[model samples]
Target: MESEDITIKPADKGGGVVILDTKDCVEENLRLLGDTSTYQMLEKDPTLQFMERMRGLLEYGKERGIINEREFKYVRFPRVPVFYHLPKIHKKLQKPPGRPIISGIGSLTANLSEYVEHYLQGLVVCLKSYLKDSIQILNQLSDFKWEEDMFLVTADVTSLYTVIEHLQGCEAIQYSWQCTLF
Candidate 1:
């Protein structure tokens, strides 16, 4: 497969791999990455800039008593994030789509992401629609009374992370944080 100029990805629905021409994969990925409203081209690496901004934010939080000195020190430095995607072979489009994944596992903001996730975990699980896993969906569905005229539908939000307005998302986090405090 490597010698033939192809790309391989795990299937979106089934437990197998989907292989496609490399050119087609590149084109599909580029189409998603080319959206100016969600993404922009950077001439230079933004790693330093990102680190500086994170330090400033952490320092401000420390000063405001929102974050402790130790926490600020530990969360200051962030490594670069890796971006990749999985092919959505289940979709019946002319060209198969890709689901963009920005893995923050070892990135500069990884620690911050983990912190926020930990803070929100309890509250999130308590919500009405929260499901620990896809299998849990069956438990919820079982409680529902099925009607002949009604239909069960599921929807997937495309490029959900990229399309979210930064300020609005931050405001939402802030709101959720405040609600948890009281």
Candidate 2:
């Protein structure tokens, strides 16, 4: 396996290609965590209390009928997070934002979020379909009908995710699930 990233491209015709340094990005991440250095330097073994907390959450889900025993049958231990960055390219920004969101597919919270991941993609598709009609998105329209006297307006939701409380979010999920299932 390759340990480091290497790029070979055509000769930098007048202007050169800037891969951009990852050190600044790494420093930003460490700063956000208030750590002295990279997160790997501080990574430690999972504590017994951490295991207990995860087990408690799983048991609570079972009690609430949110998850079945079958789903947890093959899950024994939580996995540690393996962090990787996906480079982000923006049209207007001269330099890459460089600060991309790190996704932990193999982290301690991964198993606990396995079920949530099931909805993440489906929610995106469903939301796209719903907004397609309401927002009058051209390509997503199946059968577009236009009226002469119609005026269209788009609404913007500000801080919808950040402002919503956990309980409210859960209630919204529960209500939507019930409506879809029944």
Candidate 3:
């Protein structure tokens, strides 16, 4: 296919590339977004609203002395996030499927998100199930005391990304944060 009429994306599973018809790529993306329970089509961009909400949250932090004046001033409105997809070539679908990716590198709440992640990093690291990398897993396996009846198992949650609702996610964060204080 000609470059102009095709879209090139990295494969979701193994390392490689998948070149697909641009129309097909667009349709696949739209189909993923068409999941009403997970996503909704907005008539207008929500950048301004998001920026304002972020500002209000920051202002509240400032008022409560949770944030200093310098930090409040330093955190400015950020650019909106960009949405794209990587082709899930490993899937056995009729048409080429894609995994949606909403990049929030410079989005309105990006800084706040980064701050929250940093704050929670300590707790996450201390969790018994936390795995830093494949090497860590290998180290654990090397020290494992296997029993005759015991079987090692692994699992992959395919729908993990779309399974949790936003409110549920926030509640989970809040719960984690509260638990950390004790």
Would you estimate the TM-scores of all the predictions? 0.79, 0.52, 0.84
Q: Write the per-residue lDDT of candidate 3 for residues 1-182, one digit (tens) a residue.
A: 35778777788877497778889888988888888877888999988887888888899999999999987876657887888888877774446677888998877777777777777888777666789998999998999999999998889775686788889988877877677778
lDDT of each: 0.78, 0.53, 0.81
Where model 3 places Cα greater than 4 Å from the true spot, the runs are 92-94, 159-161, 177-182
lDDT of 1 by residue, 1-182 (tens): 15568877776666378777888888877887787887789999888888888888888999999999778766746667776667776675446777777777778888888887787888777665578997799987889899899998899787777777889988876776677667
Tens digit per residue, CA lDDT, model 2, 45-159: 7645677887888788788988789865434565655543333343222333333234656555666567676765465455423553435666544466768997768775533
Ranking of models by TM-score: 3, 1, 2
Index of the highest-lDDT prediction: 3
lDDT of 1 at 20: 77
Which residue pairs clash within candidate 2?
A: 81-107
Off by over 4 Å in 2: 1-18, 27-48, 60-69, 82-84, 92-94, 116-139, 147-165
Order the numbered candidates by lDDT, best leading.
3, 1, 2
TM-score of 1: 0.79
Deviation in Å, model 2, residue 145 alpha carbon: 2.9
RMSD of each: 3.0, 7.6, 2.6
For candidate 3, give the lDDT of residue 2.
Answer: 50
